[model samples]
Target: MKLKSFLSNLPARVILLIYSVIVLYPLLWTVTTSFKTTNEFYENPWSMPKSFQWTNYINAFKEASIGSYFVNSVLVTLLSMAICMILSFMAAYVISRYDFKAFRWMKKMYLVALFFPVAFKIVPLFQLLGDMHLLDSLFGLVLAYSATTIPFTIFLMAGFLESISKEYEEAAMIDGCSRFGVLFRIIAPMARSGMITVAIFNFMSYWNEYIMALSFITTESKRTLTLGIAYLMEVQRYATDWGALFAGLVIVMIPTLVLYALLQRKITAGINVGGLKG
Candidate 1:
């Protein structure tokens, strides 16, 4: 029995180790390359640098408007996430709790929208934004991001909300709580896990978003990290600065890693709870 149990777990552990190495290797390589000089990197592509060149990171920030890009990305991502959460939560609650005539149709519409690709709407979106005079603005990007994220956020939140017992709301009403009060004080608390799950998903999507940011943000200083990183590749065409490029890649990756480290546990728990209903 003991031997069987050990054998059963061994394969899973080995697979986990292999997957971890596969995911981490590129990140490790990028960080190591960032510390190498350009010549050293070409000569020893796979080896660690003999001397750590911390100046590459400094150069990356000085040469590129990395600081400004970072701030823009953060602001846009946060604003979009906040707006998406509130709008999705309210919409999901209505869809889940109400027995209106169009509730079923509304639910189906949102689900269908979730399957549609953003690329399909690009032309129309661009025209609309142009007409609104929102072209090439961070605020425009934020609005677009929020709109794109809402369908998925509503879908996920609706699933979680549907799983909740309506009795909780009724009980609150008996205690003289207003609908808004019950939602804010009780139902929202119960849906915390789902909210966190949606927030994390939206954050990751917006933070790494490249296509829309590329299309909408024209000014160099207004570009997001992904856009700024692309400029490094363009510069490399003239003379390859692999060290500086890798340094920039590392800088871009740090925020994402830090965010995941901070919120991964909450995200996992939220996913587990949310999946129970779906």
Candidate 2:
């Protein structure tokens, strides 16, 4: 029986291994390509280079305002992430804990919101930002990102909140803790997985968002990394810097990797932490 089971699993394991290699190969290729000099790239696109052009990173950082664009993305992503997390947490908390009519509507309504395509609202957004003199501004972009993301974030957070036991709330109340204290000290900490997961999703979404950034920002100085990459593409027509372009892409990917690496470990811990009273 054990031999039969191992044989049956072998095919599935082989297929999965093949799939993993397929997915990872392109990423490896991109990293290797980033290090190659232009001449080396042209000479042998696939083979390893004699020496890595570390300066490609410096060039990408300097030439196309990639560093400035990186800074802009950080500013926008942080503000957007903060706004989305705070608003989602509050809305989810109220709807889950309180049994009011309007709060009830929020749960069903946000579900409907997810069904609608984001493009449907872009024109109105463009006009609204323009009217407020916020077009092309980071603050405006942050607001746009936060507003569009809230409904979904709220839904995710509320689902998590709904799963948690209200017995915790009752126990806290018996101990003379106020509603606000119970929420902050107990509920919020227990929902760490939801918060981190939603926050990371929001961060990745806004950080990589190209369309909104392009539609809103025109000035080179104010462009986010997404826009900066597009700008790099346009600039490449006149001057070839494929190495730098690849370097910029690698830079853009680093933050997302770092965030997941740091936060992913906590997602499982968050759920179990609630059970440990001490």
Q: Global lDDT of each model?
A: 0.87, 0.85
State the lDDT of candidate 2 residue by residue for 1-278, as single tens digits.
99999999999999999999999888888889899888888888898767889999999998767899999999999999888888888888888878999887868898888887867778899999999999989999999999999988887787788878999999999999998898889988888876776777788899889888888888778999998988897887788778998899888988988888888767555434431221
Model 1 steric clash pairs: none
Per-residue lDDT of model 1, residues 1-278, tens digit only: 99999899999999999999999999899999999998898797999899999988887888766778889999999999988899989999999899787987888888899887878767777888999999999999999999998988988898888878999999999999998998889889999988887887788899899989888889987899899899878988887667888888998888778878998888888877763353
Judged by whole-model lDDT over C-alpha atoms, candidate 1 comes out at 0.87
Q: Candidate 2: where are CA atoms >4 Å away? A: 268-278
Error of 1 at 179 (Å): 1.8
- Steric overlap count per candidate: 0, 0
What is the Cα-based TM-score of model 2? 0.91
Please report how far candidate 1 places residue 160 from its true position, in Å. Answer: 1.6
The CA lDDT at 192 in model 2 is 80
